[model samples]
Target: MSDATSRKVKRFSESDRNSEFDAATQKALEEIDVCQNEIDSINEKSSEEILKIEQKYNRLRKPFYEKRNNLISNIPNFWITAIMNHPDLSALLDETEEDCLHHLTKLEVEEFDDIKSGYWIKFYFEENPYFENSVITKEYHLDSATPTSESTQIIWKEGCSLAQNVEANKPGKKRRHEPAKTFFSWFNDNVDPYTDDIAEIIKDDLWLNPLQYYLVPDVEGDGENGVDAEEVSSSEDDEEREGGEEESRNQRK
Candidate 1:
């Protein structure tokens, strides 16, 4: 068993009561422990089986993901537009990085052979005024209890660093209003990798289903079917409520 699955078990204390009742309580507790161990064993086995299934499907889905990327490449600014459409991702971005992201030619998520080990998120950019690097990548290593990540350091073209520009714009003294975090600033933030909110959003949400975000109606004008931005948001909210209800129903089942 993995160390993650074989940690020390929580021991139960006997109840303080008459000797006979205490003994009975202790015996019942022991029985409960045995049942719990059995449950854990099943859970461990289930996780192994699920990982195998995920690995198998990962290989199967590789070509489709590649094809999607190729198709997306043909659409001008598809990725940048999609990124701007996503609620969480859009929040991270500001006017400072908007032009920089326009040069983003491709974005890719590559899972390791052992999917549980970790994955890499790669951003490919055309030669632009902002940075020299053609490709910037963030790698997550998930071998231990706490996951750690490393990102490619961007070599900015002289005087064109968007992150630095944002910092420089901030007032020397504390202001009542703080400047919004630029998306590029995320590269330098030393956040916990395992629970990094942006990483989680990208991997589990955006990477899996970018089309949903991409299709979101632009608030600036009427979108497809004449739906407005507010309508799109409302639709999403309704879907979320329905999804939650369905999950609750499944749990009850």
Candidate 2:
């Protein structure tokens, strides 16, 4: 009778233990389901937020598109006519087109060849007179031996700006002075919209000034170049010292 009683007690204890384990397992499974549902809900919300932001950006881009088209249409036809007429300018424009195509295809050149055209156009518009004016004037005296003879005077006159303004405001202005826009227009027209992945390829090719490149690093560390080599060595030394102190304390304890 005593042996049977002991056996029965052991069986009951085992049964209780099994029941507790099952309850714990069931709770854990429920928690996992709840966590999965929450994750799904968060992901759905994030996706919706992202879609809304994209839609907002798309709406904002509409104005820029309209402005770009208007600018293109407003471009004077005379420049195109001039480019067609002038052999040198025409050749330069053709070379620029070829270079641009090469860049779009291979992403090799950093700046478009039309950049030179733009510079020329800008110079033309500015009417810089450096090319035509020969006025000689001295302002400073170089030597003390003959004050009058050594007096240096610089002859400066506005040449290009005057010419550029005159040309730009002519009664029937035919040329486009804005080089950047001209280049952009040429790019849009010549490149295959579907196949030219140049935009994606060139997205990261933006010209960053030295300061801009390391702005964050400058803020966090010593300057744009980052903490000097000496500073880095010093920091390492400090860390080593702290580690040694920690080990020493542990040993003492």
Candidate 3:
């Protein structure tokens, strides 16, 4: 046999062939795979458990918000405060819409453990004669940052909360498309419930920001240009970081 071939062949007694180190290394690799699988299983179980708890908590939450229905709003301009607290989402709000969003009473989000149903937004509004309903609920089938309108659908529902007596005066008949020009007009249009699915309804971004998009002004939104401002701000931040890195490198010299 060639020298290399002879070297490659090892007997069981050889130190390198059956060494404890080699056995330990093999065992460690196997253990890593086992650990990874264990972690995955645990995470899956944990998520299910968390979702269960969320469902239970949501049950308690619903009644609490429902109690406020038809009652005077105690939280003054809650939507405005919520939006301003979040930088990125606030950037999406225009001056006009921000003022109009003050009337937003309650914004509830529904989460299904099953990823198929996706997430739902249930908006509770104060009585306004301008639109057909007070609550405009929509469910969007979005994954990550991409809106999967085909895989699922944006199931939209309008809730009439005019306390029966006031329902007769609902003004959707005359100026059919008038108030839509004002703030919250966007909600009146069921054709495209979102401002822009690709830009505004960034599913993951809202989740990350804890529903900052819900701070969306109660009026028709005017921040179609806000996304550009956000992009500029982000690019500026990146440049600042790069400049800091260059300064550090120069200091090292």
Every model: Cα RMSD to truth: 13.9, 29.7, 18.0
The estimated TM-scores of all candidates read: 0.73, 0.24, 0.40
Candidate number of the best lDDT: 1
* Global Cα lDDT for candidate 3: 0.49
lDDT of each: 0.77, 0.36, 0.49
Tens-place lDDT digits, model 3, residues 106-193? 6655555554346666666565433435666656565545443221122223452212212222334332322233223333333322
The model with the greater lDDT, 2 or 3, is 3
Between the candidate structures 1 and 2, which one is better when assessed by TM-score?
A: 1
Name the weakest run of 10 consecutive residues (lDDT summed) in model 3.
160-169
Model 2 TM-score relative to the real fold: 0.24
lDDT of 1 at 200: 73
Candidate 1 C-alpha lDDT tens digits along 212-252: 88788755887678888788899999999999999999999
Task: Pick the TM-score winner.
Answer: 1
Please give the lDDT score for candidate 1: 0.77
In candidate 3, how many Å is residue 106 off?
4.3
Selected candidate, larger TM-score, 1 vs 3: 1
CA error at residue 15 for candidate 2, angstroms: 20
TM-score of 1: 0.73
Number of clashes found in candidate 2: 18
